[model samples]
Target: MNFELDEELINYKEKVRAFALKEFTEEVARTHDIEEKYPNELRMKALHEGIIDFMNPWKTMIGIEEMCRVDPGLGISATVPYFGAEVLMLHGSDYLRENYLAKVISGEKMMGLGVTEPGGGSDVAGLKTVATKNGNEYVVNGSKMFITNGTIADFFVTLVRTSKPDDPAKRHRGLSVMVVERAFEGFSSNKLTGKLGVRATNTGELIFTNMKVPEKNLIGDEGKGFYYIMEFFNISRIFVAAQSIGIAQGVLDRTTDFLKKLEASGEYVGEERKFKLAEIATRVEASRLLMYKAASFLFNYKPNPTITSMAKGYASETASFAAETAMEITGQTGISTDLERFFRDSKIMEIWEGTSEVEKIVISRMILKGEKNE
Candidate 1:
């Protein structure tokens, strides 16, 4: 058995890489990163050019890797418009599928998932956002924090508590997922600026002050929203792993170029530098293998939490490691370059989707519970 990408995937990867190189220029990346601006024009161009296809998960995964490899902020901005459509696809009703999915898929509208709330870092069950059902509508209140595509998205797949739990220990039992439209009365968002990395992507806090969301917008069963969101995370963590792999790889590429120039100038290129490259390269390979392994289980209709967490956790830390190593290897040059941006961007990979700590908890618990795959 071999571990080569099929001709189809290879060709597609090259196509995306070429598009990124041609269109996502250094000037554009630097400008966006420095100005803390969302790359809407680039996003529109990528959509029109069909550089990102959300319908196919594998393509989406590969496209993210290739685009991010060039510039993390711009790449992430361009590819993040359909951030939460998976929830609608997986658990939404026929009406949602026909109405919302088509618009998002056509790139006519943007979307995001709202799971993290103010004061709720990764504790989804501990969310304070509540949606009170009234007749045929749900009046949503409370706020969501650190929502990607927040200010720009036409709607959001938001999680909220639908009722008080019978048991104090079962807060998750009352949690539910529903779609909240931007045009809804009492719905507002505050743009969050000055991010450490991924400055080109939109980030904001969503406030729902007595906003009335249609009851029909609820995804799946009422109490099962938590499970659905968890399942989505199990799937999404793979993509996060992919994103981390991309950052690591981009750092590796730039660092390699720096080293080559040093060697060309007859600067004393030591074995230590060579070994560092080897280590970064090896970790990148291992992260890719882990991501693919996790994706194989997920995309094939079998979700493996242990493997997925392992991939997401290890890959994110690997990204940080690669970026820091690149900084160390390039020294002063790294500071004067975009590798600094990549270094900053590498950090969030360990924080979002699931923190490195969260992922470790997931991995350890799964293995100890005897749910690990052989």
Candidate 2:
């Protein structure tokens, strides 16, 4: 098996890294992070510069890793405009694709995914959002919490319950995915501020009060939204794994430089800190390998969900571990520098796409079902 990245991917990785280093400057990153503002300009710039290429999943993965290595907040903000585009690409109708997805791809519009409800964190099936059929359209009512690009997106690929389940045990049934437009009369959003991490990416509560969505906006078939979302999660988790590895690598880079500088200044660095750095580097490398394996399976259309979960779960934990351990190594200097921002940003990696606990559950269940990692 080939372990090295192809020459093209290597060059693309460098291109993305250079773009991020140049554009995601310390001032720009700090401004967005401290003000809790979305970097719309960087988003547009990334789009124009071909920094966000979804057509090539490998490029997309590498770009996320490289950009986020520079700054998670701005990096994620730059890439997430097309967050839920996969659902549309795989399951949306031609009309939905041409009208909505095309615009989003061309950067004429932005989109978000609406799944997590205020009352439901990882319990996607427990979401209370309802879309009652009314002739040719569905009237939606409910709210989604902590949605990325919530307040700014031109549209949302929203999951809503279409009918009551025949059996309470099958709450996941009768759910559907719909493209809800921001201009819908009953749609509103409240921007959420003071977030713990990734604050450069917009987060908000999406509320729907009798919001009307056309029947044509339904993605795939009715009663199939749960499966569609699950499939999307399988794909998204790989990108999240990339994001995690990026954070971990970034932390390692900073910590190593710090130690080198200290040693250059004739300071005696302890063995404990050296060991921590070594552990961080090892975890980062392992996370990348897992992510690459998961990506290879997924992008080849022979997806192994167990491996995907393992990659995401392990990488996310590694990001958090690397950041925290860097803090321990750097002590006061860590808390005072951008490493502090990295620490704050590393947290949400374990929470979003799927929580580390959620990933563990997926991994165990798949293993019990006789799924084996290749």
The lDDT values for all models are 0.91, 0.95
Per-candidate TM-scores read: 0.98, 0.99
In model 1, residue pairs whose N, Cα or C atoms come closer than 3 Å (at least 3 residues apart or on different chains), thus clashing, are none
lDDT for model 2:
0.95
Please give, for residues 1-374, the per-residue lDDT of candidate 1 as tens digits.
Answer: 57888898899899999999998898999998888888888888898888888878889899999988999888889888888788899889999988887888887888999999889998889999889999999999899999999899999998999988889998889889999999999999999998999998889999999999999999989988889899999988888888899999999999999999999999977989889999999999999999988988888998999999999999999999999998888899999998999999999999999999999999989888989584
Question: What is the C-alpha lDDT profile of model 2 across 55-168, one tens digit per residue?
Answer: 999999999999889999999999899989999999999999999999999999999999999999999999999999999999999999999999999999999999998899
> What C-alpha lDDT does candidate 1 achieve relative to the native structure?
0.91
